[model samples]
Target: MHVNARFWDRLAPRYARMQVRDPDAYERKLAMTRAFLGPEAQVFEFGCGTGTTALKHAPHAGHVTAIDCAPAMIGIARQKAAEAGIGNVEFRVGDLADMPDSPGAYDMVMAHNVLHLLPDRSGALARVRRMLKPGGVFVSSTACAAGAPRLFRWVAKAGHALGLLPLFNLLTADGLRAEIAAAGFEIVEDWRPEGGRAPVLFLIARKPA
Candidate 1:
């Protein structure tokens, strides 16, 4: 998938409800994140689509600067934050290539599932690296085919062929670790989902102090 504005606009409804269907999964990730973040720290969530994760994690952090490339996504996110009455978050529409951000402005930066969309994830990681406070964490997750069913694997490749799965970098654990290391981040935590059924690799890495 191209992952442009249209792709997200089409995915908005389903994306908004993903948390409800898998709250446990999301909650687990949040718990992992809280392990690294200070109680009053600032969080910068790049590609914070629909604000679901932002709303869930905002109360824990002192503040959240949520951003997404799609204006439509940010529009809905702002509304969600407002309806939740969360006053600590600020939403912006911008791409990872050029963030409307000052360098080293956040204690932590989150990329979520955005890495797979990047054609050059290491370069993107470098961009994010320069934007964090020294020793800040870069928490992210990406799709992987390491545990996919053979049929699903075939389907994913087919989806790519059909352009429904444009450019996803299915980074296995070691692959991702190397990518982060190459970008000058140390692996703080890393895990592959159990059972080899879910094709996702979740991780946390940080710039050296």
Candidate 2:
């Protein structure tokens, strides 16, 4: 996680400048997530990169605690939030696992493009489940590299070996869904957007009520 944090810190500026590869798909994700949010919803978002999604959701949610492991990312997020005049979000730099336990504290928890980078995906999901209230939704978008093209997978592996990329777990869509279920979530929506080299799985799962 430390290495990944440093990598993200270095990439933060460039990453913020890069546009979403699929704007339509990204918009769809935001809309779908917003549908589950009410005016009074309290949200927690982990690995909240530059906090674009958090800022977008802040209008609908009552409060959003956006956390990232990289200090640079959180700094950029704070700047963006301020520029957007979004006061509902509080951006912090820390690992999700280190967050003080407050059982059933949030109405919704989101992790976008983050799960595959973790060493303990199952344990992370379990912690997320514990943070949510009963019936609370967990929204996530994960890149299932195991389903990606062979060449791309090979390149990714080479990059990791060369220290150009962080550790990534090769996960399949079905495998991720099973893990979510095993973590005590009832699957609500599972979607794989069309036309990406790698499969990006977007899911909305609810804690059993």
Candidate 3:
């Protein structure tokens, strides 16, 4: 995901205007995530595009710190937060690597639809692990490019090659689980919702107590 910010900056406006393709599936993910949150929770989210999920989760947590690499994305996110009068979530223009090296800082860390897009997936997961308090949870929903149809995979790669898409890793759901485990997080919930155009791997993992 570390590339020129212009790519995402160009997409920010249209991304904000787009509607959720599956409201039911989206609500299910939201509910599942909310179950892990509490009023005393301190939450951190990386690769937060437009701050939608962060804003939604704010009511359940004490504070939400969300970051994205693209300035345009953060700009739009800040606007959304102000318009919605949501004051608990702080949206910033930064990458995961820019996050402070503060171990055990957050009660929960989330990365939704972001893992497969990272060029350094293992490094990012390790960072997430370090940022969470012991026994705290990491929740993620990743697009499993390895599980996509052959034609889609080919097209995605071609698009990346032509600079039409961002960096993407063809990581399988099993491989993602293995990586999270290797990062010293215990997988507690592994789920895949049905009837999606592509496979999404939803997981809740906890740092060792």
The lDDT of each candidate is 0.79, 0.93, 0.90
**Best candidate according to TM-score:** 2
- Model 3 C-alpha lDDT per residue in residues 46-107, reported as the tens digit of each score: 88999999999999999999999999999999999999999999999899987679899999
Per-residue CA lDDT of model 1 for 50-151, tens digit only, reads 988888788888999988877778988999989999999999987777765578887888988788767788778888888888999999977765555678
Superposed model 1: Cα runs more than 4 Å off: 1-3, 19-22, 146-165
Best by lDDT: 2
Model 3 alpha-carbon miss at residue 98, Å: 1.8
Whole-model lDDT for model 3 versus the true structure?
0.90
User: What's model 1's lDDT at 15?
Assistant: 81
Number of backbone-clashing residue pairs for each candidate, in the order shown:
2, 0, 0
In model 2, which runs have C-alpha deviations exceeding 4 angstroms? Answer: none
Order of quality (lDDT): 2, 3, 1
All candidates in order of TM-score, best leading: 2, 3, 1
